[model samples]
Target: MVPEERDGRDHGEERERPRRARRPAPESKRPAPANRRAPAETRRPATTARSAARSAARQLRDLTGHDPESVTSVERQRDGGWLIGVEVLETHRIPDSTDILAEYRVEVDDDGELVSYRRARRYYRGRSEERT
Candidate 1:
């Protein structure tokens, strides 16, 4: 075959040169260095004392009637459980005020189960009891 020329250039010379291979598209849009860590790797799971305290508070509220006046204090025990002190703020038809103004000692396990419960002390509604 005869070589053809256009504008004083040889078409055969252009065809003889090798064309560049096309590159593959990048696997991800984000740059490699910035996207290296997965979402789970970047963030740590959270645990806190406040979360435990709040959980204990919710448990106490559920066990006792949702009476704001009933619960006096809540404390976390050394064994990772809860110690809740509840006051008998009001009672219906009980003759002795001591029976009405009792203090309930509630023990809750780490999983918020009622481990044990009892009336620790009784006092008159209008008077304090002397400890012996």
Candidate 2:
């Protein structure tokens, strides 16, 4: 009946309608937030050669019970892992330390953990393996 009262009701009605429509759009994006967060794994990307080699060294010390002396080579495997060749001081001797240099084949998963490893070769530290 009153002009002021009519204007207030009209304004109230307009506000309510938009709120109802926009509510669903935001809820749709709620599920999308999970998808957005999934790319976090992708954002990190794969491991680098340096990091893989370091991992190989640390793991070698733990698995082999010997300190890793140095890294010889690093390569990326087709199965989304790293293959690293590590040289460890297996034997510590005086004057001419009889070193057992081993090529440790290392493989790391997506989570940056050592999934698998094995000794590829065992050789002396002072002497280099002659590749023919």
TM-score for model 2?
0.59
Which 10-residue span in candidate 2 carries the lowest summed lDDT?
Answer: 14-23
- Per-model TM values vs. the true structure: 0.41, 0.59
Model 2, C-alpha of 64: deviation from truth (Å): 1.2
Model 1 scores what on Cα lDDT?
A: 0.58
Location of the lowest summed lDDT over 10 successive residues in candidate 1: 43-52
Backbone clashes, candidate 2: 0
Q: Write the per-residue lDDT of candidate 1 for residues 38-99, one digit (tens) a residue.
A: 57545322323344445544564566653324666677776667777766543544555443
Each model's Cα RMSD: 16.2, 11.1
Clashing pairs in 2: none
lDDT of 1 at 129: 64
